[model samples]
Target: MEFLNDYLMIIIWAVVLVGTILIEFETSDLVTIWFSVGAIGALIAAASNVNFFGQIAIFIVVSLVLLALTRPLTKRFMDKEVIKTNADRTVGMHGVVVTEIPFDGKGEVKVDSQIWRAFTTQKDPIPVGTRVVILDIVGNKLLVDVLKEDL
Candidate 1:
């Protein structure tokens, strides 16, 4: 009981700091990060032999302050809609035929920075260097059509 009071704050603040930081890493949602920052303030204050009330006050104040200051900024920047995949990006983009494609045979086209296996709907073969648009993706292949230029 006597030993508990002397070291309780230091121990408690250390655990809070480590625990909140672990949760922050797991979540990456900015929810627990403010609490971790607050715990750090308390940890330092407690380690420097601050009183119990002072340690708790610093903990609460720093947590609330950090939360208030950074929540809006974090929401503005980190909460935006995130694109998870680039598969949809390939659609509607223009690419150049890298390998002459027979109507019934597989060929290759260079789109943006990627080379994709390509196929066509026409019976005639598309020559290399012809500009094409990706129409759809089938398995690992890109279904493409020649983009006719304005005369």
Candidate 2:
């Protein structure tokens, strides 16, 4: 009992530091890092013979202060940029219908030397060999329109 009372704050702070560091490594969210720093502050207080309540107060104050001060700056630095893909380049390009496009069903089109599943909103069926203009891609399918002259 006496040994535990003497070292209790030190043990608790050490455990908190290790646990927060492990959690920070697993998540990489820049959150638990503040708590680990807080645990370090508490550990220092305990080592310096600060009262138990004072150590707890130091931990809370340090953690909250660091979180409030740095989280927004860290978030801005961590924001990811949107990336363009090769598939995105297909929009606005022209293609030829390789299979008859039934008004209610999907069809295949040949665009830029590659074949893609295509769909159209036109009420009439599109015949094979008709020219189509790629509009947008949905999932693995392309949304297309008949070329103006093909109407």
Question: Which digits, one per residue and each the tens of the lDDT, describe model 2 over residues 57-104?
Answer: 999999999999999999999788978789999999999999988888
lDDT of 1 by residue, 1-151 (tens): 7457658888899899999988888988887998888888998888788888999899999999999998999988887685556787898999999999899999999998899999999888999889999998888899999897710
Candidate topping lDDT: 2
Alpha-carbon lDDT, every model = 0.88, 0.92
**Residue pair clashes in candidate 2:** none
**Backbone clash count, each prediction separately:** 0, 0
Error of 1 at 102 (Å): 46
Off by over 4 Å in 1: 1-4, 82-151
The alpha-carbon lDDT assigned to residue 103 of candidate 2 equals 83
Among these predicted structures, which one has the highest TM-score?
2
Query: Would you estimate the TM-scores of all the predictions?
Result: 0.51, 0.55
